[model samples]
Target: MADPAADAVVRQMRDAIMDTDLKLLQAVNTRLELVARLRAYKRSQGMDFVDQAREDWMHRYLAASNRGPLSEEGLHEIYGRLLDLTKAETAEDDPAG
Candidate 1:
């Protein structure tokens, strides 16, 4: 049975979810910009921008801090994708890009 009121509530929640998605997109872009700037500064200082130890620490820290319905695999996937996006957005280091 299709209830109109339930449909309305679902529609409202979907709209809010879509808005959150837009915010995520904006956040990723902001992160990418900041990473690019940091990478440039590190390059000038004769240093490597991508720190493997820091990345490992971040994953551990986030996993410990997370408290939600989000699964461990989902969190790892999102974190990996975020790192990949930031790295791909920055140039000079990746010759293939």
Candidate 2:
């Protein structure tokens, strides 16, 4: 049999985690919307959507800002995935692509 108190604590923690997940989803959507706008602006300026220098700068910024339970490698992995997703999302939305 489980301790009722422990079960209650676990439920609370799970709820908190779910809330954080929802917030992360909201943030991702917001970022995607901004990416769409950026794509349009860049298109008007006759520029490519993929900017390697900007991505490098972002990685450095995130590395500097991270005070993490997540290691550097973990951060890189996550950001790399994010960049890939962002590019894919932008490409899908891009009319020219």
Candidate 3:
């Protein structure tokens, strides 16, 4: 049988990882909420959602936001995925309008 202490340690690590994931989920949710607001504001301005300038700005923002824990590429990838999802969401709203 596996050592009891080792099993306990694994459980502790798993719990910590879950807690971190929950926090990340909350942060991502907040970011998505902001994206939705941005979509609304753009609509008000008679502007399209897919703005190259905005994407460039996001790249610069992400570049400037480089901190420890996540590499720049990883950060970009995460935001890229978020942007993709945001675009899809906005597109859905458009087809129905």
Candidate 4:
């Protein structure tokens, strides 16, 4: 037996979260698409896809830019996963691999 007002509040919060989740999904897909294009350009130039220095720079840059309720560790965790996912997606687009 939930209070009606509380239930409405919960529903409203859930709806907002769902909208944000959809935005995140869209952003990730857009990033993957850009990664695919970069992979193609690298392939044309015979360049290696894995750039460790660039990745390190990216993590540092993101950490510096973050002004957040999210901790540095949390930012690292999320971006680390994103980097892995991006690498995997780019690899999948590689014809030579």
Which digits, one per residue and each the tens of the lDDT, describe model 2 over residues 35-92? 9899989999999988999999999999999999899899999999998998888888
lDDT by residue (1-97, candidate 4, tens digit) is 8876579888898899999999999999999999899889988999987799999999999999999988999999999999899888778768786
RMSD of each: 2.8, 1.9, 2.9, 1.9
Best-to-worst ranking by lDDT: 2, 4, 1, 3
TM-score of model 3 (CA atoms): 0.72
Best by TM-score: 2
- C-alpha TM-score for every candidate: 0.84, 0.91, 0.72, 0.89
Can you write out model 3's per-residue Cα lDDT over 1-97, one digit (the tens) per residue?
8876579888898899999999988987787777777778888888777788979798888878787588888888887888887777655656423
lDDT of every model, 2 decimals? 0.84, 0.91, 0.79, 0.91
User: Who wins the lDDT comparison?
Assistant: 2
**lDDT of model number 1:** 0.84
TM-score of structure candidate 1: 0.84
Q: Please give, for residues 1-97, the per-residue lDDT of candidate 1 as tens digits.
A: 8976579888898899999999998998899888888888888887887899999999988988889688878889999988987887787564433
Cα distance off (Å), candidate 2, residue 70: 0.8
**Lowest lDDT 10-residue stretch of candidate 4:** 88-97
Candidate 3, position 54, lDDT: 77
* Residue 85 alpha-carbon offset, candidate 4, angstroms: 1.0
How many backbone collisions does model 2 have?
0
The all-Cα superposition gives candidate 1 an RMSD in Å to the true structure of: 2.8
In angstroms, how far off is 82's CA in candidate 3? 1.6
Predicted structure 2: lDDT? 0.91
